[model samples]
Target chain A: MAKEVRLWEGNHLVAEAAILAGCRFFAGYPITPSSEIAEYMAVRLPQVGGTFIQMEDEIASMGAIIGASLAGVKSMTATSGPGFSLKQENLGYACMAEIPVVVVDVMRGGPSTGLPTHPSQMDVMQARWGTHGDHWIIALAPAFIHEIFWATVRAFNLSEKLRIPVILLLDEILAHMHEGFRLPDSSEIEIVDRAKPTVPPDRYFPYDESQGDVPPLAAFFSGYRFNITGLNHDKSGFPTTNPEIIQRDMERQRRKIERHLDEILWWDEHELEGAELAVIAYGSIGRSAHAAVDRARALGIRAGLFRPITLWPFPEKRVAALAEQVRTILVPEMNMGQLVLEVERVAAGRCDVVPLGKVGGIPIDPPEILEAIKARV
Target chain B: MAFDYEKYLRMERMPHMWCPGCGIGIVVKAMLRAIEKMGWSQDDVAVVSGIGCTSRTPGYLDFNTLHTTHGRALAFATGLKLARPDKHVIVISGDGDAAAIGGNHFLHACRRNIDITLIVVNNYIYGMTGGQASPTTPFGMRASTAPYGAVDPAMDICQVAIAAGATYVARGTVAQGLLLERYILNGLKHKGFSVIEAMSDCPVQYGRRNRMSSAVEMIQWIRDHGVPVTRAKELPPEELEGKFVTGELHVAERPEYTEEYRRLIEKAQKAAEGAHG
Candidate 1:
């Protein structure tokens, strides 16, 4: 079979990549920028023997994906700002219950419904802290069409492997933009299925930590008569009010994610051979930062780019290490200053963290990023 | 094999959080009996629930169960059913959880005609929240929120389910355990969306506050006014003024949601092949 070179929109590529990655279920409500993902899925999923539902609302869409995940399917949903906010409650439910799901939030500026068809990376902090309670969230942002497709696949792979939800963040520029896409050969790309229980059906405990901190999940109707609950439970999966058990559940949720940071976090670091300045950025903003770094280098300034592919574990150690190597680290974002606060907090006194925030539904350009680097240098 | 309630229930989770004399237990027992009678293994069943006293039913069931957040069980069950069409998905929810907060999901699930058995324990009040007025709370029934008495008329959940396109819709009182059990059995057997509204008594919440003094009085009220569909057909409309008919009130044949989607997949796959050609 010969591979086809296809022209693909960012959203279409995400849908194609997701199907290739074995996303058999998708439920979402239409919202701008994100609607293309839903539209593509609605037509494409059925052809691949997958289910696509335009739910009554975003809330149900979130709920449906969580349910499908619990039933042992690779499930996902796409939405924008308002829909993302609507999904927060069930996203928290997916976290507490340890259901593996993928949520794609195509950035459109907002505190409310800001700019529907324009790009903004305002959800950086919200992506991590949006859900209530203590939760380990893995979010991936892509700057271009190819990256969005890969991010969608990685989101599914990481979700199944980690037994937690993954958010694939894309700005409107990345989601709706059309580009020549080399159709990824499904067989060439690695895919991961969720781990199944090794124990006998009768002996199964849905939340059994004895198997591992991240317990193996048995599909709902796979003859494993286990239980799942949002409430904190013991090994038997019944709701436990026991304080020790509650503490254990909370600790395990936090510790499992923290321990696996090395496995989850992916970052980009450019030339920094005795460079005095570092520019840390993410999403589409990082694209500009990359170009700016190149421009700065041409201008005889020593600067490097550190782009974090994984947002939640926040690449703390990497940022901290980078901090020690530089006098100042400039953090630029499409938001007022969401990711910078995290960068600043981690950098500590090792460096002066400067923030270059951009809003009004527009992405910062290379010149803008170069200005930030020049001023800081 | 004889039906064994103990085999299906997790006794350790017992002394279930339901109040004394509450009818939620009866509904759970009836559902268990239905499962037992159907000869389905606990392994093949996924019992899901939203938050409330009735939602807690899945916690005690020795099945693949999920106790989810308030009122989203149908939406959750929709996904579960679609993912593994081989598994039977059953949802247990409360009056408020099903008809109030979760009503939109319920409507959509029915509209989809998804293969899910939703059995709502309509207790007329929010028992878990301490007797607040619920969607099914009768007009003039005093509740914690309606101290002076509920001024709004109650919403009939059966009509809502039918209107939402549920293939099977039925209402049964908890007092009539045998009959409710039969309807539940039929619901479990139904291939499309099925809704079994088990109108139950909340002795601690709605009963104590209202004129009903004991669980018996509440049970008696249903026993007296609850007319069977067969009998209601014989009686004049004026003669059955306040009586609500029980027994399988509605049954229709529709293409089940997941199965329809499966056909859609075949057609879409053929279309894609043609496009490739």
Candidate 2:
């Protein structure tokens, strides 16, 4: 039986859910929209035998999470625009080193601190490619408070399962807004622990591909002595400058995520049985788009909504398949047409791609989306 | 008869990468002595290091160790400590790695006051990358980049750590071998963020660039000029001016970052469980 949940702000729910998930280490600096996460962790982490640190800055916060993760703890950090920018370098290192960590970016208006307290979906590209080099990134965006809790849990599970960093992309509205969330009973959720090598210490190779794709992690002081590095490394994890080794290693790192695409991609479709116009969006904006699509349908328009939960390893095939059914696709984002370009590329001239975007942190009003959808219809 | 320190040493690997009579060797010995005194199971301690000549400390030791990227040892060690707070995490880094590129992390680690011991070997210049002036390079020190001499003054690491909220802050020199051992041990025992800045000699790069030619001469200079904070207090300001004050500068107690966080989690859990029950 589903019980009525009292209204809870998205940020509070995320913080509460983090505590429930057995997250014991949170190192972050305060920033707008995301400040509530740090504040909640600061007050809540200690009550549950967890550690909360407001680092000197975002770089240190990132470093601390990596440190905490290595110590065999589930660790996370929260940040916004500029702080996210400061974290890219270490984020790349975490990916290359195969460290399991969760980084929450409650994105704000930016280029450089453009709108500290406002919302923007401008970080989509940065979250994917801001870090140097080629590496797989798992990013999830939640549309509501309950989703924040579930998404954070998913972030941790994916991070440990893939042995890579997972990013939870929240916007200002969702991170700061209020919504009731039902806390899951402990038995309801499945938690995944990092894989420990079953091989004896003497025979263990840190990065040995013998496991097929995902290698087991040997915790420090485990008597399994094996090298770990950020450099392009062989299965033994020692530095290798060989081009073939570098190429193979990079592909393997990417393939580990790409090969599991079936389990990674997620989306929701609304009223698209025979739609001629499709509206695509994500994060908080997706919620608004859903309402706008409903309003359009009441006015005799064949407008539909498609919302993606997994932003990267993008559901290109799904979008392309949908494009074949629709004559036009409208993408509404909080940025200057970032996701729209992606939709256009995937649509591949089969459909008209229209971008409805706003800068300076103001969310695209539902009416603006409705009008766009109505015009397309 | 000196317990045959050489037996434990990696002899074949010698013709050490460090210059002749460098103080790093003395500091490493002191560290080893402290580790021995603690009687920690070697398997339970991980000596992590970042890129620098001092970073080589992990490679020569038999314990589980990690040699990480430049200026990121603390970051890596933080992960190691959080993952297993039961294990001893000792981070050995140079002035450049700890104070320059890693300055932000250094300050926050002090502020967080987690249970970790950081030994910063301050040679006052970027030795491994060539004699570039570092955040700790004294004013007017010549370096590859500062050919005209550095106009910016060096940062006092002990003062910075104290200001940044470290529970334990101390300064020692490799020249004072016994004192250095005591300081390292004290830092290890502090139970929170502890920083021991061992003023070391980089005779090869820093000394050559700044005109202090030999490592022995550098050690002798530190021994003659380094002033104890207690004794220096009696001396006039002008007399203590320009001299490096060496000793345990500060110690205090506060709820560490991890402990405080743990408390919050327990409280939240109790409230939730109570309400549900």
Candidate 3:
């Protein structure tokens, strides 16, 4: 059979890809810009013998996905700005409890529901630090419509394999866009499941790191009964106040992600062959940055694009390398200077770092980014 | 023969954090007895709780227990029940955890009529938080936050559960141990959402602030104020003033949520197959 091509909306593709990725449960509350994900899940999940629940609110939605995950179901939830804020508490719970869940925040204009229908990447930092305390997070920003499907599948893979929550960040534009793409065969996709304990129920510990950094997690009803608490806990998953245990466990959780950066971080570089200027962007604005880079190159300016697919665990070494090779790096984003802060820190005055920040609830067009690239060159 | 409570408990984790004379122990015993009577496999039961003194019950139980964030136990339990319909999911929460911050989840869970039993320990005060007034604190009850006495009217938890569409709604006091166990057992056996408002005592915090300064006095007060629902109806409003009606307050039959979803799945699968055909 020739490759089957289908026209799919971005949010609908996320729901479809979740099913293909073995996401068997979805719980969410309706919110603008991301509601289509929930709507499609409601219709599609049951068809695949999966469960979908419209929870009472965003907090409950987050809590439900965590619960489903603990019960050994691959689970997810999707929301927008205000809803994402409401999910922070349980999101933190998922972090502390080390439950693998996928949360999609289709970004819209916000400080507080500033613009409901328009696209904005204002939640770049929030995805990294929305939940309180020092916890590990893996956030992926996929630019293209087709990438959203694979990115969601990858989100589930990372979430389950690393035993941590994964945030897939999309702006309203990508969430609402329609595109025709080939659906890959099921045999072509790689799926990762959480490791199960080899020990009998008698000796099982939910957070044991002796086996590896990411402990094997047993399903709730799989004859392995263990405790899960939001409090700082010991390897047995019981709450503990011992400073030694707390310090060891907290460090282990961080190392679980940090040591695996080689597996977690992803980015793309374009035309960086002795380029004089590089434009760093992600999410919807990444498309504009790519266009502007090509335009600048056509205008006889040495411009390149560094689009980060994995926003967190920033591509420090690559961008720093780019900083050395290029005279200037222009970072354009939907929000007022979020990712640029990280870029600036990594550059450390080795090269000039400029930010083209916008929050007007619109995409930063190619010409605008090209103008920034021109000034720097 | 004496019952082996230790068989169901993680004895190493105790002595528990509950203060002396706390009625939470009584509620825990009743729940264990009910579960024991039901003969449930320990591995198949998942006990969940939110933040509060009562929420500590799950930490002691030797089951698949989850100590979740404050007021979200029901929300979490909902997901667990839906994901693993074969597992027996129960939630333990305090008045403030259930009816205050978790109030939205509480109402929606009842309305959804999912097959899960919720035990809300109504201690009338936020006992874990140094005796702050809770939603269940009586209008004139003294608490740390209600120094002059609580100005807000107390909530009738059983009534709220019944009105919110819980298929089984019951109230039992710690003063009535065996009866409390029976009510809990019935709630567990109910086919849909079951709410059991366990009227427990917070003698150390609530008792000291409200003049019932000892465990005995608090138990005695609850015993004196609790009238069986059948008898409560015989009394006039004036005669029933400042009293609570206990026992099984409401029972109705409804389609359980998970079972309904199973049917939905079958229909959806058929429709999808037909579309493909």
Model 1 clash pairs? none
* Candidate 2 lDDT over residue span B35-62, tens digit each: 8778887778888887888887775666
Whole-model lDDT values for every prediction: 0.88, 0.83, 0.93
Residue A345 C-alpha lDDT in model 3: 95
Q: What DockQ does each candidate score versus the true complex, computed on alpha carbons?
A: 0.83, 0.47, 0.94
Give Cα distance to truth, residue A258, candidate 2, Å: 1.0
Docking class of 2: acceptable
Worst 10 residues of 3 chain A by lDDT: A1-10
Clashing pairs in 3: none
Q: After superposition, which runs of candidate 3 have C-alpha atoms over 4 Å from their true positions?
A: A1-3
DockQ score for model 1: 0.83
lDDT of 1 by residue, B152-206 (tens): 8888899899998999999898899999999999999999999999989988899
- Quote the lDDT for A228 in model 3: 97
lDDT of 3 at A165: 94
Ranking by DockQ: 3, 1, 2
Best by TM-score: 3
Compared with the true structure, the alpha-carbon lDDT of candidate 1 equals 0.88
lDDT of 3 by residue, B121-198 (tens): 999999887999999998898999999999999999888899999999999999999999999999999999999998
